[model samples]
Target: MEYYEGSFDSIVGDLVAGNRVPAVISDEEYGWIISISYPYKSESGELLGYVCADISMDSVVRDRQNYLLSTLLILAGVTAVFAVLYYVLFNYVFVRPIKRMSGAAAEFVSGGRDGEFSSSIATLSVRSRDELRLLCDSLKRMELNIREYVNNLREVTAEKERIGAELDVARHIQSSMLPCIFPAFPERREFDIYATMTPAKEVGGDFYDFFMVDERHLAIVMADVSGKGVPAALFMVIGKTLIKDHTTPGRDLGEVFGEVNRLLCESNSEGLFITAFEGVLDLGTGEFRFVNAGHEMPFIGRKNTFRAEKIRPGFVLAGMEEMRYRAGVLQLNEGDKLFEYTDGVTEATDAGNGLYGMERLERVLCAHGADTPQEICEAVKRDIDAFVKDAPQFDDITMLCLEFRQKTPGIKEEEQ
Candidate 1:
């Protein structure tokens, strides 16, 4: 091997010493370099040796470039696929719900009724168990709840209207039961009487009536039932009728009250009772006999002064089966006035939770004693309203007033 190497070097040096051009030639088998001399020379201007370097990069450079190109193409394709999938998912799950929700919100804002919100975006099954799905579910449920609430509100409002209508009818019927026409008998100049009732609610249990017992006496009655509404109204009717039936020109006031009390107790079912004041006025003598049944004291106005008359009150009717009553008498001179009322007046409460007590009522009566019966009643109502000052009325207020007049025999003859 050493001799061969030396021989090859000597030959290459002789060729390159001749100033030859070196050429590298390669083939599939192996690679080598050849040197060719331009002019033949031996000692002068000759190359020492041919210089050559040969290397093969067939596996390293070519294979690496091809591998890199293939990797880049695979990565681009994968990225494209991922981007397409993301686009599809975003449109189906996110974009679709957002669009539907926006449209629904717009419709709701444009005067849509409660039923319009029933439609939901939960039908899209793309991302069924994710946050977006839960959001959609919640929205659907909220819409359902809102719809149900609105329906309930409407039903409540309708029920309230129905109750209000029934109450109105009840009020009309109750008012008809009383004497609404004023000046009941305008031509009977022997006396002037008037009464009024203002109920806190649509219907009340306060009532008043006046009727002539033959030609010599006048009957007046005022009552307040224990309860309110239809039951109390019915009781008031029974009480008034019973009292009127027993009242006659010569009938004793105490006997009339006792009989009425016994009759009420016999038929009373809910333990209802009444506080009543009944009176009979002799048209000729101006003498009044009255009975109080657990009622308020009466006020008499004479010579421009009003004072509460102390009268003994018997037991409330319809509560006891064997109750007794007594009568009290008062002689009313001509031009004398009498006032009677229910406890609703004195018990009226103000905004400050203060009662319009007996003292205030007396003051009101004295202040408006000279006015007509209607005017006096109005004055009392105004004072109550002023005192209450936006507070709710809790009971029925009623009032009755009477003026006595002696019939002149000569004038009656003249009229006849």
Candidate 2:
């Protein structure tokens, strides 16, 4: 029954090579079998005798099929595990953070700038310790910055509106202080008078007025105060009041200015000063007596010709105490025009940086051909516009004009 005797030599050959030998044998009891012989080695790898085992042909085929099935099942299980892990990584690292940021941005936009729902921007949980976390931090910071900017803009707009309202009120009060009514000195047949004051974009202190001191003498004033805005306006009120009060029936022109100057210097805490021209015209004899306080020269027009007068200028009022002013006299015949203005008129600038000086003013006056005071003023203003078109107004322009008609007939009594 022992079957190892026939294959002993070949088994030894296989063992020497340290390999397995497989052989087919026919046995009467087993009916066709396969024999496998393997070498046995000691701990030092020294080969010993071979060991042989026999299996029936049918059983060998069955074992091979079972092994194939088990291998396929194990491989499928491992692939499924990897697929789940890949999905988790993609969702956490890329998809989830993007979705959360998109949602947050949408909500922030749909809500108003001051909406309380903006806090959701900071509540996102994209803490992957990677780009997702960095993106979250940046989004939160941007939201905070936007909100802060909105708040600051609101504050600035409100402050601007408040200041604008106050300026509007101030502008109204300043306009009221001047003589704005057209055809000033109505019901006076001896002369025709008109005056205008245009303020700068910022409020300015320039004023003009003409009033009858008595039945025959007309007082005319043109003045400009230092600086601008509310302070200049308040100072203008004081100056205007002082000038009117000191011009009485018996008061001299220079002496009136002298007293006003003293009073102004005492109250000028801001060191402000005024350049002014005050003149009184006698209706009967056509004598014009005037005093200038460092102001611009007046223009006289006769028979369609205009010329600047050669009169001396004195120190500005409120500049020094006890400043003395002198009166100058000029004779204005019938149909003669006297024009006075602040520096703003001559200093008007165009976009080309050119000044509207005395030459242009004289040309404009002559071009008018001896119009009424109102028409002359309008005509000159048109010329100035043509010269300085589209230029930003740099200063306040004030102009006063008066035309002398024939002397009052049989008015020897009105002169008193």
Candidate 3:
């Protein structure tokens, strides 16, 4: 009875307290609280404990959860609608047309024939004034232009090949005009001679020749025309012919050059000129009579010593109508050698633009002074080839060497 009264009293006291509320706190796994308040009344308006009520918040929490779920469902439905529209619009507006054009371009590059583009693919109708449309138009035009351009290119290439073949034939003919067989007139034991020419291109203006005017006289000639290629080659042919025609046994070297110069000047076209050296050797006497027309000085070698011979200069042939050349005479002893060449031989260039000049040529001759004419020529060629290894020969390289030997006392003479 006391315990029940105490509990009731405590409840009534809490309710009576001014502005106080009764609360039940329960410990569950998460915990919970329930609170209630009641007004109290007494006699003459004095306060007294009355009644109270309380409830837990579990039902309100469940309603809030239901509201959140509804909101999520609405958002997911909206997203699905947007996704379906986006995929359909994207496929229609972008993907299909691009795939078609890509296929067409691939086919075109892989040697597809004209009008072979797939016709089943429809032209894109989603036209906007943007870069993609312009790109497609440009591609189509480029395809057409490429086909025409390639056809034109083939024709041009074929024409070029034809012209190249003709030029090769011309080059061969020009080479044949030169005397390639060495040691010409080898049976004449008095001297040995050798010459060579390497043109800068298919044909060149430099030339050399040696032939006997008679049993006692040998005519040697070397010349360079003013230019290169076919025009110069033609001039070279004319100049070579005139020089050989005028040089004969018992004829003066100066007169031979003078006559040739006048003849060249009369028919000179294209303003061509030639630097030349012509010599007539008396095999029996070892006497050399030579004329120079603006040519480089010749080197004379005897007994392993070589030196340049100073000769009077005359005007280059074909420059003037009445040019006269004077002859210079030098006595060559037995075992003496003479070297003559066009400027091209000394002017051959390396990649560094250095000239194979007179100094180097002289050094070459001096170094190989004891070698025969054939050997000397070979030595010079080898040195130049080494000096300008892998470099293009920039000019016509030509050289001639003549060696005099004394006739034996008992040797029988052969009739010419």
Candidate 4:
């Protein structure tokens, strides 16, 4: 074979420029070749010849492609194995436990009042020694606490409902004890009487009564007991019964109160007392005899003008034993009215802590001049409500109004 010469200009130029670069070229003889060159220099670093080498790139390219293919295949196999292992480990360590906890929580919430939630949460198990286990344990304790709290809440709610029901019944019973019917003395036309009581609570201590002791004498009572609610209401019942029982047409007013006071003092175990006012109006003579026991002053309306009656109040009933009370007498003419009330009217509070005082009461009474007893009471209540807008009533309010129209002539007294 004839020898052939090949040009290596690119490789020689790179060697001269102090670059150690290899060159690839296509050749008729070698098909594909890579030429590399290194300079053989003198000790003084002068220009010198180059030592060159040519490598067949076809085999090298094929070998490199084979090596890359093998590497990629090995990498793909390793990655597939790693992915499978990861899926198994992750499912067992994290996903499975998490799913179990989620299922148990769902069941607990949906279990309802049959109490299966406790068992569902308590039986949950997490095998991992990580935050999952800690969370499972915490969930169990929380479930127990929540269940106990719910049970206690149910008991308390039931107890409150029972108490509310009892109080409702007590309110109705107490209301029935008073004279709720209107036209109290419909048979007699000598006087027109109207009275009302508004309790601060379900039951109150304030009470009023009007009944005929005889055909000639009409007895009226207005009283307030100490305290409020059940205890005071019970005391009110006793006091009202005692007052009515002792009042008679022939008995002296002072003597009647004296006996009632002694009886109340004997059974006053609760330290409760009453401020009471009782009056007997003789319809024939227009004579009014009344006793004041630590009670508010009565208003006398004469000639269309009202004035507070000045009477010295005696000690409250049940305050002490052997307390002597005095009686006051008033001559009632035709068209005269007597208005009586408890301290609740004068002491009614407003949102601003101001009192609906005696001044306001007297003003309200005077404003409703010559009005009927019913109209007068309604006027006063309306005025009080206006003055005490949105404020809670702090005491029991009671009122009684009796208008003496005329003396009944030729009316025979009924035998007692």
| lDDT leader | 4
CA lDDT, candidate 3, residue 73: 88
lDDT of 2 by residue, 102-215 (tens): 999888877754444366787887768887888899999988897888778778989988988888888888888788887776677889888988888446888777788998
State each candidate's clash count. Answer: 5, 0, 1, 0
Q: Give the local distance difference test score of model 2.
A: 0.84
lDDT of 4 at 57: 75
lDDT, candidate 3, at 110: 58
lDDT of 4 by residue, 247-288 (tens): 976898899899999999999899999999999998998889
TM value for model 4:
0.73
Q: Would you list the rank order by TM-score, best first? A: 3, 4, 2, 1
lDDT string, candidate 3, 181-216, tens digits: 866876888888888887887788998888888877
Please report, as a residue range, the 10-residue window in candidate 3 with the lowest summed lDDT: 1-10
State candidate 2's TM-score. Answer: 0.72
Per-residue lDDT value at 268 in model 2: 96
All candidates in order of lDDT, best leading: 4, 2, 3, 1
